[model samples]
Target: MSQDPGLWTVLLAMIAGAIRVSTPFLFVSLGECLTEKSGRINLGLEGTLIFGAMSAYATAYTTGSPWLGVLVAGFAGLSLGVLHGLLCNLPRINDVAVGIALMLFGTGLAFFFGKPFIQPAAPRLPGIPLGDWTGNPAIASALDINPLFFVGAGLALVMAWGFKTTRWGLIVRMVGDSAAAARAMGYSLGQVRLICTALGGFLSGIGGSFLSLSYPGSWNEGLSSGQGLIAVALVIFARWNPLRCFVAALLFGGAGALGPALQSIGISQGYYLFNAAPYILTLLIMIASVSPKRSLKDAPSELSITR
Candidate 1:
């Protein structure tokens, strides 16, 4: 605990903001977790994320129901993932190249649909009352945590357990690690990747829903601002562990908020540098996680790229 009231207040606010802000990253990272664990990388998650945000905003605006928007966004994400998976399945195509192409396509589609969504105000998400114990307005604002935050945390817990304990989890991991082994055991690797890719897309789509329907309550070209890319980075930092995703997301969120936090205190140094927080974190984590030795030894033998 800090003796300074203002510093303590800022710290508390950061904690609450981290929870609210990490929701989208949590969902998107979890989605990537599935895709990566199944021996594929969806670089198109960036595009998928934007398209999902646009789709969710548009659906919610049109239907007057936030839940429907979320489902529709998920389906849109699924469609994009399926397309990417199908393309990656082609013999001459590379998964990374396919991802790049899908990223362009997904973003283009989002901008197109986002035309009408810029002005629409869909139903905003209801946040949890985290400061009901205090009657002060500052406390309430500082403690307003989003429901998506808790949902994301719960999903992380579920995914971690699912990966370590379930039959489906075992099969996915096996297929990713070694297609030859999976084939020897009479498993279909392509099918496994397809399922995981679709699931990943679904989760990414839900992440988009969190952005447009909750944070901004509107859609635009800049709504995401590279959150999709950040999510991809978060997955690696998590070491493929879902629980760690939540913590990593919060860490990144705090980094993302550092600029704003400083401006509030009238000390705005290194503002531009703050803008690079997520990217810097991503690069550092990637460098740390990837290696010539560990990658060669620990990466899935059947993975087409890492090898």
Candidate 2:
């Protein structure tokens, strides 16, 4: 059977868009999932994402190596994550508050340092053509997957396994579930949380790298568009499951792609509303995930917001 040209084009665009847009979401959600698994939340990842984008673009422009740019972005994110961890560890400090401050700081730094790179070109990440054998340009283009996507998928699988079997994963889960128990077991709460937060930041940075080096393939002020914040909500929706987080990120990516896909098919009316699909999806997901009778069943017990 054959499909209408417009419908086929829209479907193809959405498929491609879902893959392209999901990269950042996947990485950020994974990072958030890891941090939450250790009983910490970093809302400042929005900053991390922006900063990573700037850092990656700048480094790629200077070094002519997109991979190097990705690496530097991760380091930049690690720095922010470390700062957040240190601040939150201080007596009477709140994680949420520190995260907000860091978010602002990261965004400011990105804007300041990113000014010169605004007009410069950077190396882009290489993509793999998964649908090469199909002999269809649209299919080939839609399947032109970047390496980072595979990395994110592998990480999700590994995380799912590690959480159930690895010693460190068990420790992280224990720490997140009950601080008192983790403390009783001779674990340092601050240390664990700090490491996880930094790791989360690093992953988020890579997500940012995917932005500047891959899709949209440029450095800009509005690069992130709240993907980082949505990641936190995604973690909640995923119930802190790494595999589920991957699926949730794709769902969001697909939602984000809807507007562009519709436009590609000449559906111009309500274009702005279509563009707001991701945010709307986020709100709806949050609402559906919540319950008045009790807390989310899978939330980490030691998370301050949940308690």
**TM-score for each candidate, following the candidate numbering:** 0.93, 0.96
lDDT of 2 by residue, 233-255 (tens): 88888888999988988889899
Which stretches in model 2 have alpha-carbon errors above 4 Å? 1-3, 292-295
Candidate 1 has an lDDT of 0.82
**Residue 173 displacement (Å), model 1:** 0.5
Write down the worst ten-residue block by lDDT for model 1: 292-301
For model 1, the superposed segments whose C-alpha errors exceed 4 Å read 1-3, 294-298
**What is the TM-score (0 to 1) of candidate 2?**
0.96
Q: What residue pairs clash in candidate 1, if any at all?
A: none
lDDT of each: 0.82, 0.92
Clashes of each: 0, 0
lDDT of 1 by residue, 1-307 (tens): 3347668666776676677677889899999988888888888998999999999889888888888988999999999999988888777778888888898899999998789778767887677777878998777876777777888889889888988899988888898887888899998777888888988998899899988988756788988888988898787677677888888999988877666665555657888897677778878877886875643454454566666
Best by lDDT: 2
Query: Candidate 1, after superposition: displacement of residue 82 in Å?
Result: 1.3
